[model samples]
Each structure stands twice: as C-alpha cells, then as structure tokens.
Target: MLNFSATVNQTDLRLAIIECGRIAYERHLMTSNDGNISVRMENGQVLITPSGVSKGRLQANDMLVVDLDGRVVSSRPDRKPSSETPMHLEVYKAREDVRAVVHAHPIFATTLTVAGLEFPVDMLPEVLLTLGDVPITEYATPSSHEDAEVIRPFLKTHNAMLLRQHGSLTYGKNLDEALIHLERIEHVSEIFWRAKMLGEVKLVPPEAQAKLLAIRDAYFKR
Candidate 1:
C-alpha cells in the first residue's frame, strides 16, 4: 500500500486545479474531458484530476492522490486517476524541479502539431525565455508508456512541448508556472498562424535571442 502523511493545504491545491480547469475550458483550451492536470502534494502524493470527467465541473473532491510509483493512496471512492497519469509520472521521474504537469489541447498549439508545423523559436522573446525551443515528440499512442518515453528527452530542457499529433504537455516548479507556459505556447502558436496569413515570417536575430535568454536567466537567479 502507498504511504504518506496528508498535508494541510490539499484543499487549496485542489481548488487551484479546479480554477485552472475552468479557465482552460472557458478559453476553449479543452473540451469535454480532453485534458488532465496534476499537482505534487507536500507528502509526495500527487493530486490529479479524474478520468472522463469534465474539467470545468470538477470539485475539490474530484482529485485523486497517488504515490510517485503511480499507486493510489487516497481518492474519492468513485473517482479514478486520469488516463494520462503515466505521462505525468514520467515527468516527475525525469525532473526533480517539476511539481506540476498540465496536459491540454489548446486549439492553436494542437492545430500546429496536427499540421506538423513547429513553433518558430526566433519569432518571440517570451517563448524563448519562458518555454525555450518547444520540440515535437514523435507520435505515440496516448495513455501509453511509449508516449511518455518519446517526450522524456525534451522534458529536461523545455518547460513545454507539442506531442506530435496528440496535444501539449507542460511542466513547472508549480501548477501556476506550468499553466503560464501552456498559455504562452498557445499565444505563440496564434501569432505564428497570423504571421502566415500576412506573408513571409520575420525572425529575431540570433544575437538578440541570446541576449533575451541571458536576461531571463539573470532575472530568475535574482
């Protein structure tokens, strides 16, 4: 059986996930039960959304608790873990810094992945500083270990990535940071599509890009 002491702030974390779900839904980032979210609790248990449930309607009780090894330690008796749990587990396994993982199918980002177009790193400074180069992992069947393995390499250097024909996965030191990365990816994808409509795209100079990264690093360190 899984073992851990329940933390006091779980209610707050669950509410945060619920609020994020509503925002993602209202923005049309996820439809029906299309996305999943997970937050690491103080006790090493992960609080995650249940499978097949509409994210917009989730309540605090809808969260499930599982250990790092993916063993269920606690949950509402009726709720099951998200189908994408393994992907979240793989991320936690690969990066000690990540405390939350979000999987969403925002229209613009998913559309680019569906069309096999990569987000141009040279087009946006925010994307460079916040997300780095968002790589596309090779296609793998969803809810499978194969899917997690394909993204393992990029997870170390990137906070966000497109899952080939699937959707997008983003991680961070906490839930809010991860959500910010997802929001930025969606915005950048939108800009890329708009630029395509106007004419040929323009890119930031390589030297400028390096400066942007340096500035971001310095800001974060301080």
Candidate 2:
C-alpha cells in the first residue's frame, strides 16, 4: 500500500478540492462537469481536478499535479488536467497570494455576463467589502492562454470576475476562501437579478460607502 502519511499535505489538499467540488455541486453552481478547481501545493506544484469529470464526484486520487509552468508532474494514470489549466495557471502566476481558484457557471452570474452587464458594487456593502467589484473581462475562447491574459489585469484587484458571455472565476488564499468569494458573487448576482425584476435598485450613498470601507478595513486589520 502507498504510504499516505508521508504525503499528508498533498492528501489534505486533495481532500480540500474534493470537498469544494461537492460544495459547488450542492449549491448548483456547477452542472454537468462544467467547472474546474485547483490548489497550489508546496514546491510550486498545483493540484487540480481532471478534465471532463463531474466536480460533484471527484475522488482524492483523481486530482492531477502540475508544475508552475503547467507541465503535468503527476496524476491518476488515466486522468488529465483540466482543459482550463492554462487559465488557472495564469492566475497563480499573476498572484502569489492566490492559492486556490474556482471557475463555475452559476446561473445568475453567468446571466449578467451573457447580458454584457458588469456586476455593480454600489448596491451592497457586503458585496463591496467582500468582493470589491466584479468586472467583466473581454471574451476569449476557453482553455486558451489568451483567455488567461484577458483576466490577468483584473486578478490584481478583484478576487472574482465574469468572463464576457461566459462564466465567473474566483480565487483566494485557500479553497474555502475561494468558495466564499464565489458564494458572494452568486449572492450579489441574485440580488442584481431580483432588483432588475422589481425595477430600479438604489445604491448606498457615497459617504456611507466610505464608512463601510472603514469598517471593513478595521475588521480585516484585527
């Protein structure tokens, strides 16, 4: 039998990805093998889910390990890295602080992308503080380096973004953090969609927005 105790961190990382997969599935954020997830491992390797596999049913042994340059270092014998590995690799290159990334087609957020509408931050304090502003990147074919480049600029300031006519990408320091970012994006997207159905939505005043920023800073600092 393989000695798993020696690879505890890698094992934990794999389990984390599997758990994230189930969470995304349970939340209905990913459907029919439509999303990808990845986590950075020590020594510049990245652990990612395989392509075309259902995220909801990932096994710890099914993950692929790749180097920083996107070369496959290890994986289950017959599995392959996600087709979107380039995109995830790009984010990792652009932000050392981002250790995990989640890309999904949550209906509400994807609807805004398809509608060509940017997610407006002014409507909610929590959205602003938790996600900053979710921008819409220019469209690019999935799994292309060009698509990765399109999202590079937004990665510096925003943890989440919509791919024009596509879906959303969220990243953070860990799997849970990335998932929370996705949740926040989906929540705000739902709010925006509902407000549109109800007609005009009012934004919080600028002064109050500033105060909310102050409160967020205080809490983050603590």
Q: Write the per-residue lDDT of candidate 1 for residues 1-222, one digit (tens) a residue.
A: 011123437878888889888988888778888999998887777999999999989998999999988898898888999989989998988887777888998999889989888778779877666667889899989988888889988877778898988888988877777788888888889999999999988898899999988987877531
The per-model lDDT (C-alpha) reads 0.84, 0.85
Q: For residues 1-222, could you state the per-residue lDDT of candidate 2 as single tens digits?
A: 111222348878888888899989889899999899998876668999999999999998999999878899987779999989999998999888777899998989989888878787889988756677789999899877777889988878778888877788998878878888888888888999999999998898999899888887877521
Kindly report which residue pairs in candidate 1 clash with one another: none
Model 1: lDDT to the true structure: 0.84
Residue pairs in clash, model 2: none
Per-prediction TM-score: 0.92, 0.93
Task: Give the worst 10-residue stretch by lDDT in candidate 2.
Answer: 1-10
Alpha-carbon RMSD of each model:
4.1, 3.8
